[model samples]
Target: MQSLDERCLRYLAEAVGCGSVRAAADKLNVNASAVSRQIVQMEGQLATPLIERHRRGVRATPAGSLLLDYYRRQASDREDILAKLTELKGLRRGHIDVVLGEGFVGDLMSGLLQGFWARHPDLTMTLDLAATNDVVRRVVEDEAHLGLVYNPPPEPRLRTHLAMPHPIRLLVRADHPLAAHPGPVRLADLAGHRLGTMHPAYGIRQIIAAAERAEGVRLDPVLITGSIGVLKQFVASGIGVTLLPAFCAAQEISAGSLVALPLADPGLDGVEAQIVTRLGRQLSPAAGTLLQHLARGMAGEARSGTRRSSSSR
Candidate 1:
């Protein structure tokens, strides 16, 4: 059996990335001849050329490609072993990576992340804000450890960990006349009212569009934006109202800056905020704990939203 060490793997990977043995040596702070010698030794032992020298630099031969894949997998396995070791000893060294919709990353997540980190100071967390489609795609591709998105379509490569009802709500300034209503708001009530909302591609916008079509009303928003922050600001200006997920605007509603009202229509009941991950991946202990905590909060918030949506004026 031909035994390959980590040093050769590192040098080869760097050489491939840099496209030249000399450049790889410069980056690794070693002599170019030394890197060439290592490659030659490996080729002699394995009975194949690892690199093909060319005018533009060098390219990996078929055998070298196989070795590179092995090296990549070996690194991944090592990380997994370290994660397990961390769990067995204590939850001190493991980390988590989460990708979620941009709309889900406001004041609510800020507080939750801070509180979680305060308790587990040694564990690391990464937040990647993306569109819902991109969030699901990235999770399916194993680019992220977990995902939080609303109204995601089914994907075979993804597994749903938790799903909670999260119906859309009307966001209006507290001083707006519509804020006087005690019950859920209806589309007809919004006739002639200027509105601000996200663009057509967003899930919330799709829900709003479907509702508008059913009510036989036309709501050409005065402001069409792709930014949740921009929509919130526009609604707060008292010139228009925007519909959003109740949890997304929880802070503004509580602060009396805006009011939340649910739609009375039954056609929009399937909307949900879901937690997802790659179908076959195992989460690290730190990631698992973080996922569970986020899931619990989502469930509680969803239930509260349901109650609010059903309230009467």
Candidate 2:
């Protein structure tokens, strides 16, 4: 068999990734015909159809799937090699991609990123906010070097580096009726009040849904949003209560604007803040260092009790 063309392989990978040859062409800034021709050449060389078209977009055939996996692994290995070479030259420069849930943003920005950047000044980082499931997907697909998620579901492909219990809490304005409840807030306590919540994709919402089922109660959120910022604002403005880990509203709680009340349900209390990476993948030096820093920060939050102010609430 003839050696496959590297350009053809790249075009094939992009086409599958984008789910259409034209979309891949737009991404690569090339004519659709050029991408199509490259894919055709690859098919001819392999003597098999690589992709199948459907209503949504194109999908890889069995053979194409194998090739795609091979390409991705090769690309990842190349990046690892290049990173190691750069480290050998004493250049502390490499890009680290991190995908995480929005709840982690406060802690990451306030405690981790600045210090990491100071130590490795030449390194660059990309922080992409996503839901729990999306964070897991990005790490499993090798799109990100690290993931910070809250109560993510079990996945064999994910390796958890650090996990700290950060229970879900009912967030309300300081002057709200439940603010001085003096005990764990029950779902029954939320009755007859406006409820704001995250979308179903969020891990926080997933835990909330489980608690609702276990306790035989249904919560109809008056407002549903994907952004943690919006949820904070909703509760801060006294619009309604929302479920979130205390750390997400740390600044607000500290500012005396919002209060984090522990939920009565044990299921909600089981939620954890976790740092994860793809299992078996070798991380770049910068990523490894950043991972350690993140773990330390998360551990500190747990030890110091990010929800310590709830007692005063």
**lDDT (Cα, tens digit) per residue for candidate 2, span 73-140:** 77777888888888886646799999999988888788578887777889888999999999998898
Judge candidate 2 at residue 39 and give its lDDT.
Answer: 92
TM-score of 1: 0.70
The deviation in Å at residue 33 for candidate 1 is: 21
Per TM-score, the best of the predicted structures is 2
Candidate 2 residue spans exceeding 4 A from truth: 1-4, 306-313
Q: What's the true lDDT of residue 103 in model 1?
A: 67
Error of 2 at 269 (Å): 1.0
lDDT of 1 at 1: 92
In order of appearance, the predictions have TM-scores of 0.70, 0.93
Query: What are the per-residue Cα lDDT tens digits for candidate 1 across 1-313?
Result: 9789789878888798699999999999999999988888888888899888999998889999888867865664566667887998678777787888766787346566777777788998788877777888777655578998877777887889898877788889999999898677788888788888887767778777788898788777788887888888888877789888866877888798998876787656568888998776677778778888787766776676667758932
Please give the CA lDDT of all the candidate structures.
Answer: 0.80, 0.88
What's model 2's lDDT at 9?
88
List the candidate 1 regions with Cα displacement exceeding 4 Å.
Answer: 1-81, 106-110, 181-184, 303-313
